[model samples]
Each structure stands twice: as C-alpha cells, then as structure tokens.
Target: MTSSRLDGTSALVTGGGSGIGLACARRLAADGADVMICGRTAERLQAAAKELGCRYVVADVVDEDQVAAAVRATAATSPLRAVIHCAGGTTSVGPIPQLDTAAWRDTLELNATGTMLVLKHSARLMARTGGGAFVAISSIASSNTHRWFGAYGVSKAAVDHLVQLGADELGGAGIRVNGIRPGLVRTELVAGITDPGPVLDDYLACMPLDRVGEPEDIAEAARFLAGPESSWITGQVVNVDGGHHLRRGPDFRAVFEPMFGAEALGGVIPEE
Candidate 1:
C-alpha cells in the first residue's frame, strides 16, 4: 500500500489510457489523490479509470480546446495538485535527412507541443489553486544520438527544454515543473513496433541493473516528482533508465536493416 501523501488533492495525467500514463495515474490514486486521466481513446480511458478508481476524460493533447476542457473538468472535482504529461509518441523512425516532413511535424506536434499545451493549461489552474507540480514524460533518447530515433529524440529534447522554461516561469507561482527521461520501458507502444527480445537483451547487457525498465519503475519517479518529496527539485530531467543512459542506446538500425534493406536506409545506416 502506498502512503496517502496526496490525500485531499487531485492529479491529472495526460495519455492516461495506457502505458506510463496509466501507471502514473494508478500510483497517484494509490497515494490518495483523486486522479483523472485524459486520452484520445474513450474505451481505453474508461477501462483505465475503472481499474484505477479514477475519472476519465477523452481529450487529445494536440487539441487546444479539448485540453483546456479536460483541465477545467478535473479542477471542478478537486483541487488540482499535480499534472503528468505523458501523451506522446513517434509517428515515424529513420534518419533525419530521409525522414518525412509530415512525420517530423507530427512527432513534434504530439510530443513537444502537447507537453507545452498541457503545462500551459494545467499551470493556470495550479496557480489559482495555490500551485502544484507538473511532470512531463521524456526519453533518454533526448540526450543520446540513437539511430532511427531522430524525430522522437528531437521531440523529447524539446520537451526537456520546455520543462526547464516552465519551471523558471512558474516558480513564483509555487508551481514546480520537471521531467522524467525513461530509458526502455516495455509498454504497448514499444510492443507495437518491434519484438523486444533482441532489444531487451541489448539494453540489459549494457545496463548496470541488467534489466529493462517497467512502467511501475517510471511511475515511482513520477510519484516522487509529483509529491512533496521533490518539493525543492524543479526544472530537471530525471533519468529512470536503470543506468542505461550511462552507455549508448540500442542500435535500432541494426535491427531493421535486413527488413528494410541497406538501400532503403540511405545515409541513416553506416557502412559495416
């Protein structure tokens, strides 16, 4: 059982339908916060909320109106004390030069812009309610130059800076903003892309902890940042990758090369 550090407070988690978002919601709820989760899918949101004993809101982070409405609805139910921005994903993966412009735009729009919008609206409510904490789900790829993770890494890098800027601007309002850069967590998003066997092995070999991260691992970091434990910590991106960041990331190009062929990878894949 988790401690009730957040009793009588409320938390809003974007992308809470599944994966890291759902984990964060459950952790906050367990800590005695009235949690509300928002996502684009109604069915997933309903199921997640039911399981977490929280509320659900169908809202896409990319949609400004929907995000504002979600915040307003959550605030009406309880004092908004925490906001976890976890709704982001890469639309495509490849080298920057060959990457489609549409994919690049979409990635930034979802990962970076989405975090900004959530932080913007959530901060406003937090300021009115005596302030709170804001946590954004970032990626260790933001710092490393991982092959085939160009757009995703770039977008997360943008999120890292946004968290810093938000922390600086909202400090006067008593609002603390931070980010969690998870390494390789086995979530549905990861499962949809490729088999985890080889990737997990690669990560475990380099990771000091000798294992891949779980959703609950990142959830614990989110819990710390959202709760009073991290009151003095702000504007920082915490790495929760089980020491994977100390070394390089998995070479995704090596995994996809045979399927896509060397010619298809263009300059993205280096000569062996």
Candidate 2:
C-alpha cells in the first residue's frame, strides 16, 4: 500500500549501459527518479542514456576519482537519493592453485574495491542532502560454493560483507545499504559463458525454478530495494535466483574443464 514513488530525486547506476544495469536504470526512472548511468564505454552509455532519456557518464567504477565524479554529477541535478551499483565481473576464473595473480587483483578491484568507492562517495552526498538507498549487485557465487570460483567468489563475498558493514556504519547518517545476489542471469555480458550448450544446461539442473533469470527479474528486486517500499530494510542481501540457492551451485566443469585442464584444476594443496 506504499506509493513507492521517488520524485525529485536522482539515482546513479554503474554498468548501466546494458544487461542488469540497464534494466535497473529503466525501472528506477519509471519510479520517478532522475537517473544517471555510468560505465567505461561511451558508445553503449550514450545509446542507453539517450534511449532511457537520462544522463550518462563514462566512468570506471574501480576508479575512485571517477566514482566520486559520477556521484557528484548525479547530485548536480538532484539530491542523489539512490545508487544501484551494477558494475562487476571477473576475469579471475580458474582453479585456485593455477589462478593468475593479476586477474585476482583485477577481480577484487573491480567488484570489491569498486563497491567501496561507490558507497563511500555516494553516502557522502546522501548524508548531506538527507539520506538514500544504496544497492550493490553481487553474485550467487558469493553464497554458493563451487570449484574454480575462488577469485570471483571471494570478491563478491567481500561485496556482501561490505554491504552489511556499510549498512551498519551508515545507518546513523540516514543512509541504507543492501545487496542483491543474482543467479545465472541471462545477459549478453555473460553470453559466452551461459549461451553455450553445457553451461546454461548445467545451471538449469541446479536451479529449483529450473530456468535462467531475465534482467528484468533482477530489476524488479532492485526497484523494491531502491524505492520507498523497502525503506526500513537494510544490510540484507536478497537472492533473486529463482530458488537456485536452495539447490547446489552450478558446476562449470563442462565450461571450465577444457579451458583449465581437469588435471590442473585438480584441487591439491600447494606446498608451504
């Protein structure tokens, strides 16, 4: 029975050019918030912003200065009432023993560090103006365990923890922080991984609802968290994964075994 409106406020969505980010941006705008989309690609951002009738800033969420700038820019037009952080992915997938160090760092920087910067900067504006809702997009990998998911899972786990910490710390400032853990969502960004034969099939076998999720599915959850309906909710990470959490995490051996030979991915404790 809540109005669930957000007139006169501004929102920032990282990775807003496409996929879940774009869906979230569209939904937030529909709820009456002025929206600004940010990402590293100018072409995609420009196209999405134009189509959505919103603003776009080409900024990498991993860059502190860029994140701060995006937050400031969003606030320039409105009080920056909401921020949906959807900018995350990882190149650090492989067996732990053979995981590339550089890729691991990159993953942490993109997912964990990026979330830190967004929360840090956006909270400042929201605190000064009044308060706002911040939603971090995490992955099912954070909660569900699987092989060859070390780096990405660890980074997302950091994000989940950060959401809780941010909610606890920033509550005094009237800001609320929450997180969403999406399951195998069908997005172009992950086409290479899931569109292929076995990955998608393998995922379905593990989902209780037994189907990949649409971008809009995640968007619906995000809209509730970002809007007034969930005003009292904070520090929670909701799973919009079609009950996938009830089952075991998807096994990517079919997808990853070839890339990382089964022999190498063979989990063995490295000598101390």
Candidate 3:
C-alpha cells in the first residue's frame, strides 16, 4: 500500500493548503510522485510546500490563465500524470425563492466553471504526455437533495456531468476523468455545522456508518484512481460517503434556519 506506484510522475493538487487536498498531496508524494500544490493563499501554500517538500503555486482555479500556468509549472520537470482538483466550496445557501443571484453565479463560477478550467488546462498538458488521470473532489449533495443548499448542489451536479463528458472526450487522448463524492468529513470548512449539536446529530443519523469521514479516506481513493490500480476505470463518480447516499442528505434546516429565518425555509423545505 505504501509502494511508489507513481514514481517519476508528477501530480498537481489544488486547495493543497489543508483538509482533503493536503492529505491527497501527502499521500501522492509519499508514493513517489513529484507533487505541486496550488491554492489562492500564498502563506498557507508556502507552509504546506515547505512541510511536504513539494513545489507550490499561487493560482486561482477559476482563472484560466492562472490554472494554465499552474499546469505548465507542474509539468515543467516531469509529466503531470495526476491532477487532483480538491478546491471548491459554496457561500451561497438559501431557498430557491430567495437565492441571491450574484451568490448563485459566484458559486457556479467557483465550483462548476473552476472545474472546467482546471480540466481544460490540465488535459492539454496531460494529452501531450499520452494521457493522465484527473480526480475531482465532488460532494453527495451534487447527486442527493440537500434542501436550502441551492447553488452549491446545482454547481456540484454540473461537475459530475462534466466529469462524464471529459472522460468521454479525453479517452482518445489516454486520459481518464473521475469524481469522488465525499460524505460529511471533519474539516475546518464544516466546523461550525459540526460543533456538537443537533445539526451534527442529524448528519450522523443519516450516515449508515453513523460517523464522519476523514481526509485520508478520500485521499486513499484518489491515490488508487490516480495510479494504475484503477487503470480500467473512467467517467465514474464514485461515492466515498459512509453510506449517507443510501439514505438521504442531512437536514441543513437546523443550521440554515437561524440565518435565513425558519419561516422562510419552512415555506420551502418539505417536512418529512
């Protein structure tokens, strides 16, 4: 399990400053891949690169030029065989009737369009080297319904479909595109929602395993898909959730109601 399955190759890990992104970068580097981590924060990426002993790039995935530059930098020394896009989050949350248009667009730009630009530029470099693997860190919300998570769900759903199309289009170039839908993972991003409370309890109740996931859980899957072990797999969005998808997404009403007003969300979120 610790063998150098990706020796002599290179990997580009986005949002590598922390959480699942950093975990994947560590796993990939430990496996002997020349790794380059990128993110919007210079201070964090600097710290991560120093600790991980991998190169770092300060680039925004939503920016095409920045994304393209990151790819070029990663492949400059070795073939960029693996691109793990773990950079994405949503600021937009509310009922469809009250969804902020600007927030919605921004969420789509960051999650959905950002994914396209990353894949577009990374594929250009990967195709030149005869092909590579692209792993997208998606969410179960993309497939399952999570009421009050308007823009985020829509955007991630787009990402899932985009992966399918990318896999279909890039198969000829020897590239494989896949996605990972993670369940409720313990990370700083979701810290507020998971602070020992009713919201956290609801999430645990929905999960068949009745526990949260770790960054390494998703990282292990990324390592496999990026290597030859999943050589025949492509165009598939694998769920790494703790059986949460089998039931339903957590009720965010307990959390979102306090912000957007219970009456508003109640008007929309169906009661089961």
TM-score each candidate. 0.93, 0.96, 0.96
- Error (Å) of candidate 3 at residue 139 is 0.3
Any runs in candidate 3 off by more than 4 Å, and if so which? 1-4, 268-272
Q: Give the better candidate number (1 or 2) by TM-score.
A: 2
Could you tell me which residue pairs clash in candidate 1?
none
lDDT of each: 0.88, 0.91, 0.92
Q: Please give the RMSD to the true structure for each candidate, in Å.
A: 3.0, 1.7, 2.9
Candidate 3, residues 109-207, lDDT tens digits: the string is 999999999999999989989799999999999989999997998999999999999999999999999999999988999988768898889889988
lDDT of 3 at 10: 92
Error of 3 at 187 (Å): 0.8
Find the 10 residues in a row with the least total lDDT in model 1: 192-201
lDDT of model 2 at residue 115?
96
Model 3 lDDT on a 0 to 1 scale = 0.92
Which lDDT tens digits does candidate 1 get at residues 124-241? 9999889999999999989876777758999999999999999999999999999999988878878733364666677677689876678999999999999988888999999998
Q: Which is the winner by TM-score between candidate 1 and candidate 3?
A: 3
